[model samples]
Structure formats: C-alpha cells, structure tokens
Target: MDSIDLEVLHACDQWLRAGWRCEYVTVVRTWGSSPRPEGATMAIRADGVVVGSVSGGCIEDDLIAAVRENGIVRTAPEVITYGISADEAHRFGLPCGGTIQLVVEPLGAHSRMDELLALAQRRVLTRRTLDLTTGAVELAQGQADEQLRMDGQALVTIHGPRLRMLIIGAGQLSQFLAQIAVGLEYQVTVCDPREEYRASWSLPGVEVVHAMPDDLVLEMKLDSRSAVIALTHDPKLDDLALMEALKTDAFYVGAIGSRANNARRRERLREFDLTEDQIAKLHGPIGLYIGSKTPYEIAVSILAELTAVKNGVALPAQMSVEHGKALAA
Candidate 1:
C-alpha cells in the first residue's frame, strides 16, 4: 500500500474517532489517461477537508464542493464517475478524455478504518471487502498477488506492504537506503550482527535486527516479492547472504562494491554451492551509473535500478555502474 493512502486512512480514523463524519473515496477504475491509478484513495471530512488525492486537483475540488453544499447524506456506499463527457473531462482537468470511477462511502464506526490502520501499521497484508448494499466491511489476510476487484455487489481492496527489502548492514548508506525504501512502501528490515553499528542506528518504521546476514536471509525465506541488498563490504557478512539470497526467488539480489571487488566476490561465491545461473543473477556495482559520490545519492541510484527492475524495465547496458565507468575510463 502507498504511504499516502495509509495517511488517508489514518486521517479518516482520526475524524471518525472525534465524531466527525467523513467520506472515504477510492479510485476503482480509470479509462484513457488518468492521473491516479486504480486503488488510489482519498478521504473527505464533513467540513470539506481532504487528505490524499484521486486526481490532479480539480476532481478533488468538485468532491469537496458537493460535500460542503449538501453534506454527506448517503447512508450507503455510492459509485460515482467523473469526466464522462469531453466537457466534463476538461472541467475535471482529466487529460485526453479520461474517466475515473470511484466508490464514495460515508465513513462511520462501521467503516472499520481504525482496525484497517492498525493492520497496515503492523505490516500485515489485508484485504478489505466492502458490501455495497449494506455498507458493511470484512477484513481478511490478503495475498501478495491479489489486486483490487469490484463487482455489482462489493469492493475488494488489498492493503499493506506488497514488497519487502532486506538490507545487510547498519552503516550510513544502509540507513539512507532503508529510510527511502520505507517511503517507497517497502517493508524494510536491516540486519547487522555488529552491535556497535546496530547501537547507533535508530530509524523508526524499519526493523533492525542483531543477526548474521546469511541466517537472516534463510529465516526470511525470500520470495519473488522480496529484495536483498548487501551494503556491508565484509565478505563474511555480505557474501554468504548474497549466496543464499541468489538461490531464492528474490526479485533483486545485489551488493554494493566496485567492479574489481564484485568480480572477486563472484569468484568467492563460486567456492559456495551457488550455480552459475544463480550467481549471474547478482547485481553487483549495484546501482545505476549516476555518479553518486554521497550516501544519499548512492541510495537514490540503487533504488532507481531496483525500481526499474521491479517495473520490468530493461535498462541499457551502459546505464550500469560497471559499464558506464568502464566507458568513462
């Protein structure tokens, strides 16, 4: 789930707790060139205050206007469509005659938003099923592969972390990377056996553990939705973890090092039981070639490559740090 949508849910929870009526809006479907994707959410307070966004801006303005004019009168969830006509598209600032279908539900105690927020905070994947007829909701454990679905009867939405990241160090670079990963909605865990490093690291919303990298790797049981990044240059720390992670279904397994160092690391991994194809999956010289000289910039470069891989974008060879640096040399 997006952090923005989570914030929207949090705001709705607060409003309901304070006895303020609010409407929860979700973008169920989109046609043509819409600004927000399906499953994007927004919350509108009774006084027209809003959090999160379903469109660029104009659609939000219209929704707020309606709420302020008549108040939230609906006792049941309603499906509303915006930008049906070209004129309406232009008025709503939807580009290229885009259309957005939304489920606008009047939120109250029955909304279960507080419970949903708690589950999300706990990093539990949850499915929220809303009965369109009765405004009732049911929550269940959600699968990582599940997507948002809506029928004539109900709306099913998945929430919580859909991706997981394991960073094998508590160094400064690891700290920056972990923080950015959290904002990107990844369930981030940092493992560092070195007590000195772990003692100095205190970032919130990220799980820090005092365990060896390889042990943690096996314990995580990394799946296709998981990523492992080794920032600790120590072979004893990073190499074994990379070895175990490469054997798994992890989507991205990488280590941060120079070209020569990574070559040596690969040679060292050959001493392990990892197959050639599995070792080949390692992304050493980990990030894109962004000329990153600082910790934050390096973190950005690494995440850029990770995002590209996640989206199945095939970047050119020259974009890699090794390739680009070689060309520069």
Candidate 2:
C-alpha cells in the first residue's frame, strides 16, 4: 500500500478508538478514466470528514453527503457502484462514462486494523481478506506478485510497499530521487561507503547504509519488484552494484551519465564475469528524454522511465534524449 492508504487506515483506527463511527471505503474496480486506482481507500466519518480519496473529489463528496444524511448503519460490508448511466456519470463528475465499484465496511470490533498497520509498519507485505457477509478480516503474508482481487464473497487487498529501490549514492540527485521514491511508496535504501557522503545524508524516511554497493546488493537479495539506480558517477561505487544488480531479477537497473560515458561503463562491465545478456540489461544515460537540467527535474525524468518500466510501457528509441539530439544535429 502507498502512504495515503496507510494514512486512511491510521485514521480509521483512531476514529474507532475515539468512539466515533467511520466507514472504510475501497475502490475494488474501475472502468474508463479513474482519478484513483483500484485498491485506493477512503475513510469517511459520520460527520462528513474524510481521509484519502476514491474518485478524486466528486465521488468523495457524494460519499460524505450520504454518510452525513443517513449515518453509517451497515452491519456488514456492502458493494456500491457509481456512474452506472450516462446521466449518473455526469452527475458524479465521472469522465466520459467512467464507473467505479467500491466496498464500504463500517468500523467495528472485528476490523483487525491494528495488526494490519503493525505489519505494514514492519515493511511486511500483507494480504487482508475481508469477508463481505460477516465483515470479518483475515490477515496473512502476501507475495510480491500478488495484487488486489475481489470475488463474489470476499475482497483481498495487498498492503505495504511492494517496490524497493537501492540507490548507489547519497548525493543531491539521490536526495531528490529518494524523496520522490518515498512518495511513490518505494522502500528506498541509499548505499554510500564514503564517509563524507554518508555523513551528510539526512533523508528522514529513507535508510542510509554505509556498505559497499555490491555488498549491499548481495545482502538485499533483490527480486523482480526491486530497482537499482546508480547516481554517484563513480565506477568503483556504481559498477559493482550494477554488476550484482544485473545478475538479479531486479526489474530496473539504471545509471546516470552521458551516452559515451555509459558506453565506456558497459565496456568495463564486459571485463567482469557478466554475460552479454546481463550486460545488455543496463540502462545507462538513464531516464526519459526530457532535457532536464535541475536535480529535481532529472529525478522526475528518471522516475518517469522507472514508472514506464514498472507499468511495462515501451518508449521508442526516438524519444530518448540522446537519440533525439542526434537526430536534431
């Protein structure tokens, strides 16, 4: 789960503890353009206050009004569908026939929210299975490949940050990358063996480690959901990390440099035990062709590529900065 969903859960727990009634609303399915994705959650109190979002603003507003006017009287979980017809779609402010299905469960004793929050805080991915009939929740360990699913009888939602990132630098670019990665709900760790860089690294939510990049990569046991981005521009620090990262199931391995520099880096990696296929996986001159110059812009460009890779979207060669510049020249 991302930070927003976590916040909603925390709010629900607090409200329940305070003797206030609130209903937890989750998007189970969406059709057409949706402001929020499936598994997105919102907690609405009886007084119309809310945490998180379902359909940007309009759907949330409708939810608040309904809760305030009728009260959260549901003893069991219920599925609600919005934007069924063209008129209803316009009334709900849904874009062009967009429809959303939600599961709303009133806060009660069988919620098991405290355990779920604790598991999430521990960085453990958990599967929360909710029985729609009895409003009973069951918690269990979830795999990285699992996703949210709802059958006729129950709804299962995966909670916790499934994406992990190993940033091989603690410099300015890494600072922006790590901060944004945190907002994107990536469990980020910055590894810089140098004392000077490690001393000044002070990002609050990210973990800063004083270990060799390769050693950290080995210890992390990176999997398919993991990403490794080298921003130090130091071969000694970045190359070994790339070597280990390329050998793993990591979905993305990138390095920041010019095209020529990356070419040289690839030649250098050839001297290692890496096979040609593994070496081909390196994404140097990383990020999309946005002509980004500032640290934040560069970070955004980098994440744009990462997000594309994560979503399995392919960008053509002409879209790359180097290729575009060459064509222009």
In model 2, residue pairs whose N, Cα or C atoms come closer than 3 Å (at least 3 residues apart or on different chains), thus clashing, are 1-160
Per-model TM-score, in order, reads 0.83, 0.88
Task: For candidate 1, write residues 95-171 as lDDT tens digits.
Answer: 87799999999988888999999998776889999999999999999987889999999999999755899999999
Candidate No. with top lDDT = 1
lDDT of each: 0.93, 0.90
Residue-level lDDT tens digits of model 2 in 1-329: 34787788889888988989889999999999877899899999989999999986989999888888998888899999998999988988888879999999987769988788888777788999999999999999998788899998999999875589999999999999999999898889999988888888878889999999999999999988799999999999999889999999999999999889999999999999999999989887898887788999999999999998989899898777668556766
C-alpha lDDT of residue 88 in model 2: 83
Backbone clashes in candidate 2 total 1
TM-score of 1: 0.83
lDDT of 1 at 229: 98
